[model samples]
Target: MTNILHITASIRGDESVSTGLGTALVEKLAAQSDAQVAKRDLDAETLPFVTAERFAANSAAAADRTPEQADLAAIADTLIAELQAAETLVISTPVYNFGPPASLKAWADLVARVGTTFKYTDTGPVGLLEGKKAYITAASGGTPVGSDMDFMSSWLRFFLGFLGIADVEVIAADGIMGADGEAKIKAAHQEVAKIAA
Candidate 1:
C-alpha cells in the first residue's frame, strides 16, 4: 500500500482555504490509489523548535548521547521516520508575512539533519531522502502565486528539492479576498482534480 503524509501549517482549521483544498486532493488520491494517509497538523500539535542542545544531540553518536540528548533525538527521529515512510507528501500553508509559518520552519529545521536526511560530500551536500513526490497548496489573500511579492511557493520548492523531493506541484489559491475569490478556488479544485487523477 502507498503511504502519503499530509502536513498542515494553517491554524484556521476548517476555515483554512489551503488545508481545505489540500484535503480534497488527498481524498481524491486516496480514493484512486488506495493510499494510506498520515496527517501532521502543526497547529494542533506544535513541534519543538530546534535548539543548540537538540542540534548537538542529533549529530552525536547514539551510544554517546546523554538522557536529555536522547530525548531530544527521539523527537526528531519520529518526524524523520514519518517522512521516510511516505512515498508522497502534501503540505498546506497560508502565506504569512511573505513567508512560511514558524511551525513549518521549525519542522523543516528538525527534518534537515545531516547524515540523516542529508549528507555532506566532497561534491557538496547531497540529500538522502530520494524518490518522493510532494504537493504544496499555497493560499494568499492578495499576493499572486508566481509574482515577485510571493516567496513561500519558491522557497518550499527549493527546500523540498534540497531533501531530494524534486517532483513538486504547487496549487495556488490566491487573491482570496477579491471579488473573484470563488472562481479562483474553483479553478484550484479543477487543477487538483486533474493532478489527483
Candidate 2:
C-alpha cells in the first residue's frame, strides 16, 4: 500500500491556512490512490532540539549504542523511519519570524542523521531519500513567497533537495494579511485542487 506522510507545524491548529491546504491535498491523494496517511503534528508534539549528547547517540553505531543513548535516539529513529516509509510527503508550515517554526526545525535536526538519511561521499554529501514527491504548503501573513525577504520556502526547498527530494511542489498563501488575503488563500486552494489528482 502507498503511504503518505503529513507533517504539520502550525500552532494555529484549525485556523492555519497551510495546514488546511495540506489536509485538502492529502484527502484528495488518499481518495485517488487509496493511500494511508501517517501524520506528525509538530505543534502538538514537542520535539527536542539537538543536543551534544543526543547528537552523539544518534550518530553512534546502532549496535554500539548504550541503553542511555538508545533512549535519547529513539525519537530520531522514529522520525527517520517515517520519512523512509512514505512515498509522498505533505509539509504544512506557517512562516514564523521569517522562517519555519522551531518545532519544524527541531524535527529536521532529529531526522537528518548521517549514514541514515544521507551520507557523505568523496565529492560531497549525497541524499538517500530520492525519488520521493514532496509538497510544501506554506502560509505567510506578510512575506511574499520566493522573494528576497522570504526565507521560509527558500530554506525548506533547499533543505528538502539536500535530503534528495528534488521533485517538490510549493503551494503558497503568502501575504495573507494584505487586503486580498482571502483571495490569495482561495487561489492557493484552487491550485491544490488542480494538482491533487
User: Candidate 2, overall lDDT?
Assistant: 0.94
Q: lDDT score, residue 139, model 1? A: 90
C-alpha lDDT of residue 134 in model 1: 95
Q: In lDDT terms, which candidate is top?
A: 2
Model 2: lowest-lDDT 10 consecutive positions: 143-152
User: Which ranges in model 1 have alpha carbons more than 4 Å from their true place?
Assistant: none
For candidate 2, write residues 27-90 as lDDT tens digits.
9999999999999999899999999999999999889999999999999999999999999999
What is the TM-score (0 to 1) of candidate 1? 0.96
Off by over 4 Å in 2: none
Among all windows of 10 consecutive residues in model 1, the one with the lowest summed lDDT is 145-154
User: What are the TM-scores, per candidate, against the unseen true structure?
Assistant: 0.96, 0.98
lDDT by candidate, in order shown: 0.90, 0.94
